[model samples]
Target: MSTQTGRCYCGAFHVGTKASPQTVAYCHCSDCRRLSGAPVAAFAAFDPAHVVITPRWPDAKSHAKGVKRWFCPECGTQLGATYDYLPDQVYMPVGLFDQADRWQPQLHSHADSALPWLHIDDGLPRNAASSRASLTMASCDS
Candidate 1:
């Protein structure tokens, strides 16, 4: 019920959401780790309508097709990503939150791609791909 506010590392971009996240996960996908420069990227997903994003720079880029990743022009801080595969949702890096401790990752996505040296013993569900990935094909049929 509480709102969450966040900004890019250099404060060039800002985002706020009043609605509860639709889902949260620690993603180990190669793209995520490469973009985040971390072993895992923890993010909270929300309906795009629920989030308000203000970007100081007009253009943000993504290497992946069908996905747009935004960053701060000033600091190049990776703010979030939106997938064309999931039009209803936006993924925000949990670390950007003003109070990141308040959020907990609900599961691990792309677990099969996780780094061999990095171990996660949090006991959450681990999916080879997003739990929602399987629903993608069916969703486009309607």
Candidate 2:
């Protein structure tokens, strides 16, 4: 199994995964954009059992129903998230991974919410809403 490691912006939180991600995706939802402070947010989904966060994982914050997000207490960097619908997986920002270059997004979620000014002409599939089926299927396949 391939292992990946990364740290928060302030280096106060470290994350390690013993296995490769189940899937990687780009989310254009406003909530994700606001949380990441980016036009689009990319995340790598993995089985929570395979991941470990050192120095402790701070309590999660839930501003939206069914979604819980974790951040670094020291730097406020978004660490990871878990959704009630996708309870089997945890999503971590791809930018937080040291091997981010290897984890290219496979699809775009909430494409309808994408900002007009941001144009990613990648031919990847674009889901008008949450790609729950695709995402869950990927985890099953993994």
Using TM-score as the measure, the top candidate is 2
lDDT of 2 by residue, 92-125 (tens): 9999999999998999988888999999988999
* 3-72: candidate 1 lDDT, tens digit per residue: 8898888777798888876777888888778778998888888777778877443475867677787787
Model 2 off-target regions past 4 Å?
137-142
Instruction: Give Cα distance to truth, residue 19, candidate 2, Å.
Output: 0.9
Which residue runs does candidate 1 get wrong by more than 4 Å? 55-57, 133-142
User: How much lDDT does each candidate structure score?
Assistant: 0.74, 0.85
